[model samples]
Target: MNIYLTRHGQTEWNTQGRLQGWQNSPLTEKGRKDAKLLGERLSKIPLDIIYSSSSQRALDTAKIIKGNRNIETIIDDNLREINMGPWEGRILEEIEKENPVEYFNYWNAPHLYVPLKGGEYFEDVQKRSVAVIDKIIKEGKYKNVLVVTHGITLKNILNYYDNKAMENLWDTPFIQGTSLSKIEVRDEGIHVPFFGDTSHLE
Candidate 1:
């Protein structure tokens, strides 16, 4: 079995640098355009199944790429982004630039960091992500699986593979729009990602 990870296109929050968390939002105009481009790119590639986060942006991108393929795109809530609580819909820079201490603390010490009101801890996101991956592997229903999810969720999956920490995990680069990352999944082992490949977008 193989896993291909892709993040959804840009959203208004993406432009505003807001923490989207559990908030529902759609893709922007350019994001939809990019989704079409992504669809064109994937149309030729054979995908047995497509799994996406229930969030509109992620599901929308999946639909665009799946297009007429009519591939079953499962809305896996487990693949959704981390719930940011009070930070949801708030600009990232506003929090980082103004709440420097809290931001820095969360960045450096996520294991010790507590979630804000209605927020989620890194551990919570991590556990759920791991569970979803396990379910996919156990199903063994398809040879190649495409996963469209959020930036943080993608990185968290990578962290699990690389045995890295939360802060270092975010440092990993994931470009916007039709990003494709490859990960090798052997018959009986863990997945190891090769990092995002934007060559298709290029």
Candidate 2:
């Protein structure tokens, strides 16, 4: 199985540097265009199904990428962004000012970061996202699968495939909006061929 993973395209909150969390935001013009560009790039690839986060931003990107392909596009809550809870929709700067230590831990030391006001832990995000992926893999029905999700969620997913510790969660090759990553699953094992590739956007 060939699994294609991508973060949702840029949104208003993305440009504003807000904590979107589970909030809903429409895609910016560039977001839509980038999705279309990615669609064109994947046009020739035979994708059998698409799994997207329930978030509108991710669903929109998945639809745009689906284009005219007659495949089922499923939305899963497990694929949603980390539930930022009270921090949802808040500006990143404000969050940092209000909760400096936790904010710092969130970026630099993920394993030490603790969620505030009902927010999800990084481990929680990873478990749920990986559970969904394992379900897909167990189904064994699709040859090519496309997964559209949030930036943090995508990172958690990639981290699972790479077997990196939680401390190194925010490693190199940042997951850009609409950037593509590929993982091939075979009888041998899972192999990540490429990650955070934005050649389609260029």
TM-score versus the correct structure, for each prediction: 0.89, 0.98
lDDT of 2 by residue, 1-202 (tens): 9999999999998899888989978999999999999999999999999999999999999999998889899989999999988899999899999999999999999999999988999999999999999998998999999999988898898889888898989985788899999889999999788989999888
Model 2 error, position 198 (Å): 0.2
Which structure among the candidates has the greatest lDDT? 2
TM-score, cand. 2: 0.98
Candidate 1 Cα misplacement greater than 4 A, ranges: none
Question: How much lDDT does each candidate structure score?
Answer: 0.79, 0.92
lDDT of 1 by residue, 1-202 (tens): 8788888988987887777889966789988877787778777768899989999889988888788886888888989998888877887788888667667766676666677678888888988987887788878888888899887788788788777877676577754666877666785676665676676666
lDDT of 2: 0.92
Clash number for each model: 0, 0
Q: Which ten residues in a row have the lowest lDDT in candidate 1?
A: 169-178
